[model samples]
Target: MRIDLHTHSTRSDGTDAPGDLVRKAKLEGLDAIALTDHDATEGWDEAQAAADEVGLRLIRGIEISTQFEGLSVHLLGYEFDPTHEPLVQELGRVLGGRNDRLPRLLDKLAGLGMPLTEQDVLAGARDAAAWGRPHVADAMIAKGYIKDRDEAFRDWLVPGKPAYVGRYSADLFEAVRLVCQAGGKPVIAHAWARDSGTKITPELLAELTEAGLAGLEIDHPDHDARDRAALAAIADDLGLAKTGSSDHHGTGKGPAFHLGANLTDPAELERLLA
Candidate 1:
């Protein structure tokens, strides 16, 4: 009954293909895995087919980029109707933003004396639905400008860095409502990570619960013990399902993000999908 509820594939920032990610998850002893590619549902069918072939349960999901109080927040939506018009339209805008920012990102990098063509970045994107920072990082890696995604972000791509470029993101509250409207369960992904948790107070959590937030991700590689404890308590108070996941990004992330490094309890999975 082991389930890891968040991961990515070549459809987004992760290195693995949809089917490869599924096969790897099966080999890692995961009974269930969710393909939560960033803002895209293109990987769902392929991942689902692979999961079926491997005798694994697949939870179709997306890790939507959203903004809350001027901070970036990721929302995980599961089992949604991918064709829901409004949701689909919103995803299109997000993907468009990702694509639209590529040239600007490259321009910034070129200004910093590291010129790259769109083809260079696209070469790393593979089957990705859109271009993103990770693909840019991969391009940088290819140019030997950085060793990995970590160094790339630390030096150039992250906010306040020279290569940083702003992009459109959905409003968090609206995103939650949209996911619910699309017949999906919406959960905050790694709610306590990257100092975003400091803004998600109990009062805000209560408000989001009313706004159709179904769960909170409590176990993640980025969350320490204290953060998990506090988030768990808040989730308990709000009657929200508590989720755990590896947040696997294939080789795009560190070893701590290995598949099934963190897992959701079966009962919690039931609660989340209820």
Candidate 2:
């Protein structure tokens, strides 16, 4: 009954390939896992195939980047129709933004005397459907500029860092609306992390719930105990389903993340998929 509803693969920022992710999930004894890769559904087919072979339940999902009150927010969409026109178009735009931002990021890095080329980033991206900051970080690692993803973010990629560059994201309300329009459930990912909680107040959650946000990610590695409790209370108050997930980005993210580390309640999973 353990369900980890948010994960990624090489199709996005995660180090593992889609098939390997499913096999690992099965080995980890996860009853179910969702391949919620950033902005793309490209990993679904491979992950699903591996899930079938491994006898693991797979939930097709995307971790969409979004903007709310000028801060970055991630929207987890589950069981959505991938071919939905609006969703497809929006994802393309998001992916394009990711692609477009790279050169600028590289330029900034170059200005800071840490030169990297688009080819370098693409080399790290491999077959990823979307190229993003994590891939850039991977490029930095490959070039021996930084030891790992964390260092890359800390020293260069994160906001306020020398190599940081802003990119396009869908509006939060529009993202929620589009997920519901595409017949999917939308849950705010890590709603309370990194001062996001200050922006995503109960009042805002209530507003988002009205806009078709179905769930709150109440349990996450980044959330403090007080934050989790507060979010759970908000979910209850707003009648929103509550989900928990590892937000696993594979080994590069850190040692703390693992399959089923933070799990969604079966009852909540049912509610989410309802």
Candidate 3:
């Protein structure tokens, strides 16, 4: 069975709505797909309904924003009770931080002479449960400020860029603990991508394994062959399940990713689900 465990929808920064995302996944011939919208599970019900209709196994998940040693990280939580109080509260705070940072980001953009209004950004966000840099980048695209999301980030949204702004994220160890408390499997998403890899050393992975982190998203568009091999070795040493996914964000994420561009092993899926 083909399974792609990381994806997004309009409930977060993806270009497709929840139902549409599922339908597209079905069309792409995916046997199973996870809706891992950033910081929110609002899309789960609709995506699940669509998955049921299409006979696709749905993995309800959230890509939580987290921090470790002052660096940003993403934690993927799967099969958790969405109503769990502590997890819900933390996600709310993280979404709040996303909301709070918008004006500052826009202000920075304005300073750079690419002023984009709140209405423009909101319009770009469509029905997203959480607004973030990708939505802002969409707004920029609408205004002809950039060609696509990658350019938007390269030019402004990435760390140390002129329009970049910091926001709140759960502490990494605390995030893993909360996911476990919520009865979900916690995996570090794209753990060794870009500069974030510096913060996710083997030593740290071992520590997180001790903290109940169940897996590592070793196969991702951002992880090259060498990166995946190294991460897989660490997962083996730590006895963590290794997951692979496209991290699909729809067309907005460019051609680098497609549904099932990368897939998790069926055995690994069982391990994660177990």
**Alpha carbon lDDT of residue 51, candidate 1?**
92
Residue clash pairs of candidate 3: none
Best candidate according to lDDT: 1
Q: Write the per-residue lDDT of candidate 2 for residues 53-87, one digit (tens) a residue.
A: 98999999999999987878899999999999998
User: Candidate 3: minimum summed lDDT over ten consecutive residues — where?
Assistant: 192-201
Off by over 4 Å in 1: 195-199
Worst 10 residues of 2 by lDDT: 192-201
Clashing pairs in 1: none
Cα error, residue 110 of model 3, in Å, equals 0.8
- For model 1, residues 124-221, the per-residue Cα lDDT tens digits are 99999999999999999999888999898877787777789999999999999999999999999887786343556778779989999999999999
- Whichever of 1 and 2 has more TM-score, that candidate is 1
lDDT of 3 by residue, 8-122 (tens): 9998999899999999999999999999999999999999999999999999999999998887889999999899999899999999999999999999999999998999999
Cand. 2 Cα-lDDT? 0.90
TM-score, structure 2 vs. true: 0.97
In candidate 3, stretches whose alpha carbon ends up further than 4 angstroms from where it belongs are 195-199
Sort by lDDT, top down from the best:
1, 3, 2
